[model samples]
Each structure stands twice: as structure tokens, then as C-alpha cells.
Target chain A: MSEWALEVEQLAKKFPGVQALRGVDLTIPRGVTVGLLGPNGSGKSTLMRILAGVQRPSAGEVRVLGRRPGRETKERVAYVPEVEHLYPWMDVDEALRFTAAVFLDFNPDRAEEMLALAGLDREARIGDLSKGYRARLKLVLAMARDAELVLLDEPLSGIDLISREKVLDGFLRGHRPGETTVVITTHLVREVEPLLDRVAFLKEGRVVLDGEAEALRAKRGCSIEDLYREVFA
Target chain B: MTWDFDRNRPIYLQIGEEICRRIVRGDLPPGARTPSVRELAAELRVNPNTVQRAYQELERNGVLFARRGQGSFVREDPALVGRLRQQIAAAAARRYWTEVAALGMSPEEARRLIAGVIHDDKSSLR
Candidate 1:
């Protein structure tokens, strides 16, 4: 069997005012973590949204598990948006139930385990919870599903360093091989590099560089941070 | 199992070297349960995935053994340790020579400078 779980070819998307993505080609394999990195307004989120089936592309082809993005793809793709989208009125249990209801493969036991591991109370409301708790809740919800592709759109954005560290550790450690393919989009290049099997650096709606993380480093003879600065500087 | 990580070398390579050093120095003897990935990660303040890469590299090179369910153990081959040390030294020497030449230093001057640095290591001798 081929390793590629999500493959995109000449994928392009445009907003009314801007061309968000232009001819973006990507091939992410199964069981590997990919880092989608870019600066502000680089269309990382747009590409992620397209993969998650939240947004439609202007042109080009995309295949998740060798099919178009739709109900089947959505079922296999677990997406957490960059912005906080959870309902403020929903309590922890309600949120879990809501997610469980949406995804057919959502594992309640896994959600319960993650909630305990993250030290989150089952009854706490999303609005009343702290930023750390909110982030943890989102992560738990995304990870609870046994999806083939888990797309985290800036999972650690706006969190404190301590909380970010904890969240990263939890997400990295809890992954089960062959069952999950996690793609994290972030500008925090240094913090996210270690967890990434491959990295794609986007700039101005185009993928300027893409390769295996270690191979990219070897090719440039520089750290990921140095390379990032060089590419986007 | 304490490791002071540095920024220059990659984390996984450093981990492989540290494990090799322990094996060579007899700190982690053959068949010893050389710290679990979680334990070493906590001690070194590094990601467990990075530590896992280090262990993977060692296993690939035959410097460590894993008996599934049971954790990784230091390899019993003394010759493997010697070979690894030599390979590392060769790479270091090549890097040093490349830098020395880039600095426009003659072979004699570079050798003398290197020897002088070694001579200045008073703490190691003591």
C-alpha cells in the first residue's frame, strides 16, 4: 500500500480580495506528523480548511485517502480551527458529547482518558475555563476521534509557554501509530520542529519549501529557525 | 543519566553519542536497562520523541537492543563502542580541518594550535 494519506496537486484557492493558495502541491504519508509552517497571511489556514472540507478550492485537485474531500473525507479528517470555535455555553461533557455525535469514530473512552490526563473537570463550561483548559479541551476533542488525519490549526496559539509545553507533550505522547496522521500548522517553528516528521514552509500563498524536516536541515546546513528566517526574511 | 544538551549538534545525534559514551565508560554496562525513553526525556528535559529517535539510531547501528515490551539495553559489543568513537572522532577531525583551512592557517600552525588547546586543558589532566 502507498504511504500517502493526503495528496494535493496544483491546489489553488482565492478569496474575493486575495488569492489565498496558488498551485500548492503536498503529499503527506500515513502515520507521520507534518508541520505546516508559514508567516501571517500565507494561506496555511486556507489550505488546512480545504483539507478539512470546511472550504472549497478555486482550482486544482485534492485527494484524501484517494478521494475528493466530502463526507467520507470529513469523517477521516479531524480538524481543529485556529480560532476558538467551541461554544461558550457548552460544558466539558456537552462538548465531548457534541464531538462524539459528529464523528462516527469518536471514542468516548479516549475522551475520558484525555480529560483525566489533562486534569480537566467534566462539568466545567468552556467560557468559564481558563485559556489552558480551553486549549486542552480542544485538543482532547480532536484526539478523541480515531481519525486517519488530525489537522490542528495552531493548537498552541495564544497560550502561555508552560501550557504550550504541556499540550505539546500530551499530543505527541498520546499518538497511536498507523491510526493517526497529525498535521500541525504553526509559526512557532522551533517549538514545533521536533514533533514534525516533515515540514512545508509556505509564503505568500505558495509553498516555498517542502521536505522532510531532517533532510531540509541537512540540505541547508542550518537549524529550522535559521532556515525559516532565511526563507521568509 | 544526566545530559547537558547543546544547540550546535542535533538532539538525536547527541543522544546517540551520550549513550555510546555511557557504554564505553562502563556506566551503562552490557545488558543494563539503560533508562527508559520517558525517564531520559525527563532527566534531559528533552522531548520523548527526540529520545526515541536516539534509541532508534542506536538500535539501527547495533549499539542498543530492544526486546519488545522490555525496554532498550546497552549492547555487549566492546568493539562497537570503539568503532563508534573512531567514527565520531573522524567526523570531528574533518570539521576541524575544514575550519582550519577556511581560516587560512597552515597545516603546521593548525596542528600546533590544536596541540596548544589540548595542553591548556589543565582541569582534564588533574
Candidate 2:
């Protein structure tokens, strides 16, 4: 196994009229949590989809868990897409069962733990659950897996305050140190700032700044929130 | 139970100082087991790695010690805690003075405020 969980060099992605990613290079060490931070349309989703092996990069080299992003890499990567697509008709328990049936890496014990942490009820249907609970459930599904790389795309976009707290709480509890590498994409920098070991500020399809979170704070003499503002806004 | 933080400083450093504050104040007595990084991180709503880094720093400073498989514990040395207490106080005093100065208080007014606090003027302290 390689120490690097993800390696990308000159990665590029073009979506018809829009060039979503433009020669972005990024490297993530195994077992580390990184924040891919930027406003919407900065190519955060494009890069994440490529890493998850759902979308291919047009140019440059990319690897997930030291392997090219493809079927094998997809097995190792747990992707919580920005727009989640779990069966809306299924109840919470059924959803967990479906996940277990699909992914060999799904851990029932971890699923139970995350369900309790997120305060989700097993009897409630996915459609009946509020947007916040649904968001939490999506995270639970991914975190329950023993995947080497977890990609969370905008998990905190439109949730209310208390719900957001529970979601953040789940993030704190669910991560397995030295086992899972998480890459979270969000514009809500301050909320996730403390959770990140590393952060890369993306802007207009390029990496504007990236480094160790704490080291960046010490060097820049400001929080990542402040830097995010200075970088993109 | 998230701890309050100053956004300008490093989070790990702030966390380390909070633990130090607890130790120096006897809230965490000598040899008392500190909360595991996972536990504290969850309580504080920060990353486990940040809490881990804080613990590592305290261990490096001899304020905390690791016991192989067990978690970190406050050192059993009275002098170590005493030194940290002083360090924390000095840092707080520096911060207090800087804040007062930033409020455009002259040295004489600042001295008067300090005197009022020393003389137990609770209202003035506020």
C-alpha cells in the first residue's frame, strides 16, 4: 500500500462550454483528512467525481489509493455525491440493508453506530426524513464503509443549525484514524476548519493555496476562514 | 461543549492551552487521565487529529505523559504544573494588557483599572 491516498498531476476536466478543472495538481497522504474548499463551480465536484472514478479526467494523471481511478479504485473509494440518490421510497433500515448488499466493505456495526450518532430512526422512510437527516444518512452510508478514500461533496450546504451540529458531530465520531482518508468539499470553511488536517483552496478551476491547516494558520496568522475569504472573495 | 477559540491562532495550540488550564487549576489533578483524543474531539466538535496534535505538544512540554497503550495523563510533578500555571497567567495578563491598550486607555487609566480590580471593585473589573 502506498502512503499517498490520492495523487493528481495536471488534472483537467472539460464539460462542453465550461472547463471545470484546469490543470489542478493535488496529493493527499493516506489517513489524512483534507478540505477541498472553494465557492460553487470552482471544480471541487469535478475533481471529486474523477477521484471517485465516476467521471474521467480529460488530461493529466490521477490516482486513488495508488491505483488509477476506475472500477478497482471505485471499490476503495466511498463517494457521497452532492446530490444524493438513495432510494427515496426506502426506509432507513432498508437503505442500510441495501448498502450492505451492494458494498462488501460496509460494516453493520459502524452503520448502527452512525445511525445513533445522527439521531436517525430506522422506521422513517428516506422521503419522510428532512433534508438534514437525509444529508446525515448519506454521510453515514459512506462512513460505514471500510473504504480507503472517502469523498464528501458539500455535505453541509443547506442544513439548519442544530442539524448541522449533529452532522458535524457524526463527522468527528465516524472518522477512523490511520484507516480512512477523507476529502471534503465545501465553501463552509469555518465550520469544517478544525476538522481538516490539510486544506486546498480552489478557485476558477485551479489550486490557489494548499498546505497543512495548522501550519497555514501559524504562518498566515489567521484562521482558514479568513484565508478562504482572501482567496476567493 | 465546543471550546471558544480565537480565530487568528492555531487551533491545536488553543486546545493545548485549554488542557493546560484544566491541569493548572486542579480540574485535572496530577496523574488524572485526560480524555482520549476521540472523546475530546467529539465533545469539542473539532478534528481528532487536532486534539492528537495538542496532546503530542503537551507531552513534548512534559505537561502530559503517555502510558504506552493507555491514554495521556497529567504529569504528577507539582513543579511542572506550577510552572505552567505561571506561564498561563503571564500570557493572560499580556493579553489583558494588550486588549486594554487597544481600547485607547492611557497607561494611567489602565493602572487605575488594575488598582480597582486589586481593591475588589467587581463592577470595575467588568
Winning candidate number (DockQ): 2
Candidate 2: list runs displaced more than 4 Å. Answer: B102-108, B122-126
**Candidate 1 lDDT, tens digit per residue, A1-233?**
44678889999998888999989988888877788999989999999999998889999999887778888789888899988899999999999999988889898887887788788998998999989889988899988888888999999889988778767756754566455788899999877776677788988888888887766665676777788898998
lDDT over C-alpha atoms for residue B56 of model 2: 96
TM-score (chain A) of candidate 1? 0.95
Clashes of each: 0, 0
- The predictions' CA RMSDs to the true structure, in order, are 3.8, 1.8
lDDT of 2: 0.90
User: Each candidate's lDDT (Cα)?
Assistant: 0.82, 0.90
Cα lDDT tens digits for candidate 2, B1-126: 677798788898999999989988889999999999899999888889889989999999889999999999999996978898899999988988999999999989998998887888766677
